[model samples]
Target: MSKSKPTPPPATPTPREAVSNAKLEELDQNREDSHGQFLTTNQGVRINDDHNSLKAGERGPTLLEDFIFREKMTHFDHERIPERIVHARGVAAHGYFEAYDNNASLTRAAFLQPGVKTPVFARFSTVAGSRGSTDLARDTRGFSVKFYTEEGVYDLVGNNMPVFHIQDAAKFPDLVHAVKPEPHNEIPQATAAHDTFWDFISVTPEAMHIIMWLMSDRALPRSLRMMEGFGVHTFRLIDAAGKSRFVKFHWKPLLGVHGVAWEEAQQVSGKDPDFHRRDLWNSIEMGAYPEWELGVQVVEEEDEFKFDFDLLDPTKLIPEDLVPVQPLGKMVLNRNVDNYFAETEQVAFHPGHVVPGIDFSNDPLLQGRLFSYTDTQLKRLGGPNFHEIPINRSLCPMHNGQRDGHMRQAINKGQTSYSPNLLNDNFPKQAKQAEGGFVSHPERIEAHKVRARSKSFVDHYSQARLFWNSQTEVEQMHMVKALRFEIGHVLQESIRSRMLILLSQVSEDLAARVAEGLGLAVPSAEGVQINLNVGADTDPAPYQSGPAKADTGRDSALSMAVTAKANAGKESIKTRHVAILATDGADLEAIADLMKALMDQGAQTAIVATHLGSIKGENGQQMLVNGTFQSTASVLYDAVYVAGGAASVAKLKQDADAVRFVNEAYRHCKPIAASAAGIELLKAAAYPGATDILDAEGVVTSDDAQVGELAKKFMAAMAQHRFWDRELKAMPA
Candidate 1:
């Protein structure tokens, strides 16, 4: 009977028909509204005029009957919620996470189960800034992740850099207060280059390692997706067998690590304060999901004393070369949040929020974080029930006898809320460790209450010196400049000298250079005392050695230069914004092919024309301008391409903006491409004999094929990110 009904031949769509079908489907999904449509109220009543509202007369007192005006005012009156004191400026996204393999041996966390995909919400933020602060500020970025698992919500609240400034949690407030703008003047909005910060860092020698990192390029990440994240504290990984191991969490970005030069970073802040945020948002929106691999370095309980530094020291890090990282999983952010305020703003992350198999260590800084995060939320989020917010809510069912508080969204059914109640048959019983419940490690301990830090935690300069010796020459120069800038801003000369002395303890050369810049003599080293109550003084001299010579063959895992060079070619240059400078009459064919090839390869191409309109091509075609030269600068792009037409070359040669664009790009060491006509313009602008002219080097030329080839080579050079080897003679020393 089924065969009797002859099956119709399979309908195949023609190429044009398929395209038309797609257009029709898109049009159906998105309907256009008529321009003449009348404006309506929320109730759908067409309004003839809304300007005057429901007034008695044109100039008379407005009546209370104006429901429209009342509704508008009421909504506007309550548009804000308390902003986070730290990590106030943040961007969030939704994504899924999958473990590389079963991590049951390391921990029993369900999300890290083999082949199991868990949904995650991650929020990246800048600390010590307001909601509207510039994203390019040299501040620590918060890398907080909320995993919605079957067990419960696990928040890995971390920072971009692995180490922290203070060793103890008790000093967190003091450290934060000193770094934040001074209470009296409030001069700096989101800057740490000031007197109070240097003063605090000078006293807290434990901050040396982190301070070195802060001054380095790590603080100026080119994009959020290019930065590494660290838990910043030693955590306990409890296995199913109750074995506890100290673990430090790491998030290695798939794009590798990259940073903006200080000059470029500052310029980007002025050009686009939302640079990082926009980069992330656009990447995810375009299906280029940002990814990071989760890794952990575990230290066994028996080997706790095998290292030079205390395992409980939050300021220390076990070098990756010494203790290799075990990659557990990969997190790919694929979705953007629907509502920023409800999701990004309301979501809360606490280092204390842990599931089964995850426990805390005695790291003093972490102990303080446990208290600070919860306390901060109470004040910032306006209630204890912040967990009820959709973004913060646990995926697993939650039940407790706790009574309602402000903004409570749950309603309990039973009258008897007690757990040991016969009336309700003890419905919500607590699960034991045997039944997949969270349990603290049973480590036997005995201690006398003390406020002092361990003597073993006093060797701060060794790692600081390690960091100093590890940097590449270019990175070292940046660090020196950063120190000069930060210390230069200090109003008090004494504070600057104290910092310079501290710098000398790290490296005499570094201290001397910074001191010279600040017009101060490098102060003598002040002996750092370690009160271990031993027979002899445990002086901090062994670790106070300055920079290791190039021949010393010593390298530290703490340096960004080593970290960056470690993953050089692996970084993706996709979606990197490159501004192509052009005018009305340019090499339209060469520009078109270069732009198309780059765009197809996922690199963003923005046409920077003299004005925001159509520019004539060599073949009589017209190209729509993406941005005007006045609205953009060389710093806004990863690289610059000077491909103008013969007709436009004369004007470009005389144009100050054009000259500045080329000069800035050259000074920044960004890769530049030029056609025959564009080369004339470059020559007019004094193209140095040593400069790597693409045309003379057989890289870029008039032929379309050569232009395409040049684009590929230029992209490879752009991926190098910078041409630091370029002799920038004109740049200020």
Candidate 2:
């Protein structure tokens, strides 16, 4: 017994240890032979002459016994799932939504009840790209949300823009085809600035409004959380009293609206195609939950014609100044999905999924979406049992007589599978209206069957002009720049000229400016018209005409300048990322104190060393470098801090990236802070003198208590987002 002592008892693994062991086991299971192994059939019989595939001879005809090759080819041929026709390239997150206030009077949706927390899944996407395409494409972002309420799932399938390219769903496929890469070459991916896209816009004049929006900064949003979401089509809200009202749903971001410039957007794509996705994921991980306030514009059923534009037109939008959006509740995204394919990819959203009080309007585009979504899921998910997927499944109990579909997850226990059966006591009975069941609003309808669009839907330019008029001077400049860039890419002169003519209908100044940029003359329009048999004289040209007066003040809401800071009173540099440009022998203690104070206020500080390694501080303390001067640019940071020592200043003077970093920060109107030693570095970079340079407005010059004061001032300036008052000497006059 002593000679054959029992082996020591094996130790039980901790949770972390178990995970590590499981990973090791997985690796072991995946281990393959380094040297070539004998080829074998499915039945484990080794084959000596595998290359011959059981043929009669090396050069003779192959035999039918080569089942291995046949099976391999069969699996290879069927290794793809049908991609979503739209929203193919998408990123999704899991979150929860809590209503700020009760919206029972508006709708009886349980999720909108005050204090009721409902889990939500949101998917952001690019419309035209395939599932495998890059993320940072110049395209509209689909902002769709699925709310798993106690009642059922409510889907708000919307886009970043408030309006769509087409008003009618009949033209949806055509629009998508035109914007998609040309079928022959498939040269471009996730772009609309091509011959086919321009050609489509040239013919469809009604697309002008959305085209203008697409060409603007909105299409290149800085972040998904910074953009607004809208249910482009009008829908109906039926109250408990059976009172129906025409409504438009809107999701206004708490961060306010912001966008990246075209040049920056392009550069970001190459630098990081996952820039937006990473920003969202990191922000959520860091506890900066994205939030949006839900608002709705309600119009009585009888007052639908009160607006100058048709409410049913998907291309039209009701300006907030006109009817005003009544704030309903707020939605906060506080979670991230654990799995992409199992959750994000498998989740399906349909506009047809409405609760008891929500109903659809007569918007033709919406009517078509109702049919298209369910049809797409059947093919994309491989069967009708997609609802069984965890992401798409409703939390509420579901019962139905239908069963035995492909990939069915549930097992029916009862003998009866049909409704109205006496066998199972008819347990799954239909719910009545009193039981919070869905019911379509009954309304009188009388119209001749026709394929033509309504006369009211023809006006496309007045709102475009209104939008143009409302923009601030800076926004208008950006819009002009956008127009020039998009039209400049047009290879065909006819397409450019046609677009200019359409622009002229929006604004004469805009048309002339764009025409001048393209080196083309603006063409006079003969006034296009759409024929409708409504017996009323409807001229589409009048709709294409710009507003009589271009001073509507709608631009106030359109411009980000007006909505930059959510809380004006509490404006501080909290959460702002500041770049500290430093080198060896920099003011370590002062920099440390400033950074600590910033971090205490929720700000993030990153040290940009001359190189990517440990840098010696002024006190001979080594600090781990966060980034290099060349790798991290000033454009990526909110503010710049220069705390150089004599040695560091001399070293920074020779570095071009260090010089450019300070200069670019100045050019972008960001706050800059410098110590006495840092001033010489700034002078070497030829930074223009500012009032804040010597005065304690934003810049710091002293190493005393004034340094802390200067840091506070700079932080306040950073919260201002931008300093437009700084003169732009580099701009062309």
What TM-score, over all chains together, does every model reach?
0.83, 0.82
Stretches of model 2 off by over 4 angstroms after superposition: 1-81, 131-134, 527-555, 565-574, 669-671, 680-706, 724-729
Cα lDDT listed for each candidate: 0.76, 0.73
Deviation in angstroms for 717 in model 2? 2.3
Worst ten in a row by lDDT for model 1: 529-538
> Per-residue lDDT for 395 in model 1?
88
Model 1 Cα lDDT, one tens digit per residue, 317-341? 7878778889999999998988989
The lowest-lDDT stretch of 10 consecutive residues in candidate 2 is 50-59
Which parts of model 1 have CA positions greater than 4 angstroms off?
A: 1-81, 526-568, 684-705, 727-733
Tens digits of per-residue lDDT for model 2, 1-733: 3688788855987788889999999999988773666555557765432211222332122233456434432332233366666788888888878875757787777777778888899999888888877666777889999989899999999998889887655456667778888877985778877778888788777887887678676787767877898999889888778899989999987766767556556656776677778778877889878888888989998898887788878888988877788877778887888988888788899998877888888776676566557766877797889998999999898888879889999777888888888888886887899998788888656443333455677677877877787665555666787788777877899888888877887888989988888888898876643222122333334334333344444645655655564443455455467898888988787778888878887778999988888889878998778999767677567678888577888898889989988776665556778876888776666544543334323344555533677677666666666543343333211
